[model samples]
Target chain A: MNLQLLAFMILSLVTLGAAFKVITARFITHAALYLALSFVGVAGLFLLLNADFLAAVQLLVYVGAITTMLIFAVMLSQVEEIRQGAAEEGFWRRILSARFGVIPLAVAAALAGVILYLYRFANWKAVPVAPDPNTTRSIGQAMFTTYLIPFEVASLVLLVAMIGAIVLTMKKEDRSR
Target chain B: MIPLFYVLVVSTLLFALGVYGALLSTNAIRILMSIEMILNAVNLNLVGFGRYITPSDPRGQIFAIFVMTVAAAEAAVGLAIILVIARRYGAAAIDRVRMLKG
Candidate 1:
């Protein structure tokens, strides 16, 4: 009823709608755009949770970096052939294709039902309290001091991923002959 | 006070959508995108728990950051591999990607 609740409702709706579109959109580019929109909503949710740092990272990394990369990858992959292949998959390629969607719908429904049931019944550990206001400072302090090893490992993972990507894509054309 | 269960509901819904998308998707890139959705769902839960359970410590937020880093790395590698596969095969369907399959 209040602004916070209203914001949460709207943001959650936007995020869920965008996520649905990301699955159902006809064009890959459109799907990617929807994914970015969903990421923005998630960032808003992060802010709602008082994780300002995480919100910024979500915006920068998920919306800015990942979505752009997804678009580029979609563009570079040349989706014309994909359309043809998809067409061959059948006539049921609408927003909700029965051939591809029925099971997933059932699965999502069952999952939601089970989770809500457990969540309602379980003896919860989280106690409601006013959110700690100084989240960014505390997160930064802990990242460097307490979780330094995991932070360093994350950077290492990124480095290895970079090298792996280069190796995967580095196919030299035989035109050198 | 904003109830924690609502946030949990939202995140769990997101996670379910992600699972469905990842399972039903045929496109390699879309599958990867779905995986990102799944990661975001987990991150949301982490932040929610962090806010409600241990407001004094920022461990949950830091863990979420680490998750983001790994997601970036995963996206880079996944797309690179997908690009190579698409180049060689001229299609992006994972069903057709059987080069390494025995």
Candidate 2:
């Protein structure tokens, strides 16, 4: 295999492996850490796609900010179950129970079936190559021009989310009293 | 050159995993993690399409960035709500939180 193909394979394998671990890990913190690793692997794939800017943002946001927030939430919540390492009956533990396991299996199977069907049928024709030097510059220009409004709106959404999160965490009785 | 088919198939599998985890996991935090996985799959698709279809322009990259931004916000709010839920109900498992089951 060429270097490009080899890199893609390695990055993708890393990404998928970490994602798989995220779901199956025994501890929530383990899952969160794996999530960070998964994000970094995806960033590497983005680098392969010549999306250097997107890769940077993925590292800064997904791998850094969100993973830290997840760890903090896991810490702050301090759930009794996870604190003592979940004695038993966690998600993986309960998978042996047919009643609980069947639904998720069915949901996943159905989704996979649909996606595979679409992939086989879709007449996708394009193949990507290495990006030219001006790709990022053009993107920046468009963001400030045609997409300026959407850019502003995205910032607004972030602001709303910030306020909403604060309100959601406030004491219920604080305003009621 | 890597076939786009490989990328699409991998993304589809990731999406399937996300859906499975979201539906099956009893832990609210795990569900959120799965949701993040789903979003990442979407980002991969967008980036692939952008790279192949419009190498000269990065409209697809911009869209992926937007998705990431939204994802960050969603994680912030979702975790805060989960924190509050765990605090109030003393239950990290979604199946036990019955305050809004109606």
Candidate 3:
């Protein structure tokens, strides 16, 4: 295996391990911390893919802003420490487990089927090389020019999300009192 | 020759794990984290395709960036909603906030 494959393997393991911890860990704060680690591993994977700008943004926005917000929310809610037996009491836990188990098997089967289908149509005569001089500038140019409409739509979505978050989080006053 | 098939396999496994985690986890925050993992799995596929097939255009990288941005926005809003739910219901378990369940 070459250096690229090695790096990919390492980063993939890191991401997958942390992701497991994020869900399996009982404590909310521990899950959030593990999620941050998973995001950092993803940033490393992005760097390996030569998306430097995106890697940086992943670290800054996800590991920094989002995880901090989650931690704060956990702390403020005083639910950082989960009480024992709480998980066992919920009937939804069993339902959720069954639902989750089936979906992963389905996803794995579908992905395998697609890969096999693509392999049947594979033409080995034409193999593409990796692009050289990968930079954020080229990406920005493409986004602004070819993908301008989608870019604008994404901005609109973000705007709407911001407004919705504010509306949802805002406290209602006791007008009747 | 390390076939690109392995990359796809790994990505698929990651995605499956993400889906399982997202669906099973009761805590709102863990669900959000699992969603992020799913998004990362998609990002891996995009970058892998970009590396092996489409070399001229950085479209996949651009799309991955867009994915990251959307993920960030989603985390922000989702966490805020969870906070609100916790405040109202005194807990962040998904089953407790079943007001929308018909």
Candidate 4:
């Protein structure tokens, strides 16, 4: 197997494992930590795919900013400690739900089959284009030039989100008393 | 012999798992984590296609960066909402926040 395949397989396994832990772990903090691990594995996969800029962004944005935000939210919400003996109560329901998860499995299988069929029969060729020397530069240029409108729109969306978050989190005087 | 198709297949499986987790989990934070997984799967597809098609242009990388930015923004807004919900309902489970249910 080539190095690329090896890296891809390892990262995929790590991502899947972390993702499983994220859902199954009862403690919210532990789940958030597992999510951080999954994000790191995803960053590694991005690196293997030669998306250096994206890999860095993934680590910085998702791992640094997003996960930290999640952890903060978890801490601030007063649910840091797992309730005593809560695990034993939900075991059967969890197990039963696992059986009911076959629907997504079947859908995934069908999608995979379709993707395989399309790619297998298609006569695709690599389009020759010069690789950019600096990906960050090219990305900046594209974002500021051809994709400027969308870029600005994203900024507007962020602004709206900021205002909305503040509005939602604000304490109403009537409720505070 | 593992073909590149297998890579795509595994990514799709991960995506599906993420979707199922997102839908089935009662915790709001776990749902966010599952959404991140789905985004990662899409990132894998983008980079894989870039590798198979044009290894030169880093457009895939650029797109992935955009996705990361959007994910960050999403996480921020989502966590804020969760925080407010927890304050109001005293619980963070999605099932508890059913004020919209008629």
Candidate 5:
């Protein structure tokens, strides 16, 4: 196999494995760390797909911001009781129980299978083409010109989200005053 | 150049895993994390198609950026809401928060 294929294989394995760990990790903090690792792997995959600017954004937004926020949430929240419950239940028993039973796995597997099966019939029209090297520049130009309205709307959404989060999480006394 | 088929396969599996996590996990934070994973899978598909099919137009990348922006906003709001639930109820698990259920 060529180097590109090899890289893809490694990155996918890392991404999938870390994602699985994020779901299964006993500690919520550990799960957050695993999520960060998974995000980094996705960033590498973005590089492989020639999304240079997106890879940077993935690393900065996902790995740097989101993961840290998740860890903080985990730390701030009282999740220890659930962790103890999982540990007492035992790993296999917890996963095999009716609450976390085979249904979810079956559903997920069926979804993947159906999508892949559908791919065989659909004409994707995917041609092998090398993407622009300076994707950052082109992406920037489009963001300001062709996608200017949507771009500003996204920023507005962010502002609203930030304010909403602050309002929702504010102390009772602060809110009243 | 890597084939788009393989990229699709990877993204499909990722999305499936995210679905499983979102469905199985009782923790509200875990569900949020699963949602992020789902968005990431979609972003991967967008960028992969952009690279393989429409290399000239950067629309896919631009769309992906918007997705990322919304994801960031979602994370912030979701986590804050979880924080409030946790503080009030002392647990962040979805099943535990049943105040809305009559």
Candidate 6:
């Protein structure tokens, strides 16, 4: 196998494994950490796909900002659960007692199977060529020129999110009503 | 060069995992995390297609950027809502927070 394929295999394995742990980990804090690892793996995949700008953004936004936010939220909200430990019922017992034992897994598997089967019929026009090495410059140029309106809209969305979060989480006494 | 098929497969698996997590988890935060994974899977597919199919145009990458931006915003607002629920209800589990039930 070539080096690129080898790297892709390893990266996908780590990504998928960590993603699984995010769902199954007993400790929610550990699950958040696993989620971060999965994000990093996706970033590596982005690099492999020659999306260097996206890879960096993935690391910065996902690993740096989003992970921190999640961890903080967990700590803020789950203080009691964290202190006492997530010592819930055994995994198998919980699964058995849930609404359906394996319905979720079966549904997910079915969806993936159908998508993959459909993929076989659709012939994609794939071109094997070297992509532009300087994706960051290209992305920046596009942001200002072709994607300026969308860019501004994204900024507006971020601003709205920030203000909404502050308003939602503010102390009731702090309300000026 | 890696085939686009493998990348698509990986993305599909990740999406499936996300779907399962979203379905099985009672914790609202975990559900939100699963949503993030789903978005990440979509981003991977976009980047993979961009690299192999349309290397000249950066639309796929741009779309991925937009996805990330929206995801970040979603995370912030979702967490804020979760915090409100947790503070009011003393837990963030979906089963526990049923006040909005119609």
Q: Native-contact recovery for every candidate? A: 0.70, 0.72, 0.52, 0.43, 0.68, 0.72
Write one digit per residue (lDDT tens) for candidate 6, span B1-102: 888899999999999999998898777888899999999999999999888888977889999999999999999999899888877777666776666742
The DockQ assigned to candidate 4 is: 0.47
Candidate 2 chain B lDDT trough over 10 residues, lowest sum: B93-102
Q: What is the TM-score of each candidate against the true structure?
A: 0.91, 0.92, 0.81, 0.82, 0.94, 0.94
Question: Candidate 3's residue-wise lDDT over B26-96, tens digit each?
Answer: 66777787888789888878876775667677878888878877987897789778877777777777876
Model 4 lDDT, full chain set: 0.71
At residue A60, candidate 1 shows an lDDT of: 97
DockQ score, prediction 2: 0.69
Model 6 chain B, TM?
0.95
Each prediction's whole-model lDDT (CA) = 0.84, 0.84, 0.73, 0.71, 0.85, 0.88
Could you give candidate 5's per-residue lDDT for residues A114-157 as a string of tens digits? 99998667787856575356888889998899899999999999
Docking class of 2: medium
User: RMSDs, each prediction?
Assistant: 2.5, 2.3, 4.0, 3.7, 2.0, 2.0
Per-residue lDDT of model 6, residues A1-177, tens digit only: 399999999999999999999988888788899999999999999999889989999999999999999898787664465322245444456667646448887899999999999877879986767646588888899999999999999999999999999999998888976
Q: Give the per-residue lDDT digits (tens) of candidate 4, residues A35-104.
A: 8898898888767655677788888888898888777777666643222112323523664654545554
How close is candidate 6 at the interface, in terms of C-alpha RMSD after superposing the true interface residues? 1.6
Clashing pairs in 2: none
> In candidate 1, what are the lDDT values of residues A107-148, reduced to their tens digit?
888998998899888776766566456887887788889898
- Output the number of the DockQ-best candidate: 6
Which 10 consecutive residues of model 3 chain B have the lowest summed lDDT?
B1-10
lDDT of 4 by residue, B1-102 (tens): 135566576677678768767766666777888898888888878876765576666666667666766776687788778777767776667766789632
Q: Give candidate 4's error at residue A129 in angstroms.
A: 8.9
The clash numbers for all candidates, in the given order, read 0, 0, 0, 0, 0, 0
Q: Which stretches in model 5 have alpha-carbon errors above 4 Å?
A: A82-91, A128-131
Model 1 Cα shift for residue B1 (angstroms): 2.8
Q: Pick the candidate with the highest lDDT.
A: 6
**Poorly placed runs, candidate 3 (over 4 Å):** A78-126, A174-177, B1-3
Error of 6 at A1 (Å): 7.0
Using lDDT, rank the candidates from best to worst. 6, 5, 1, 2, 3, 4
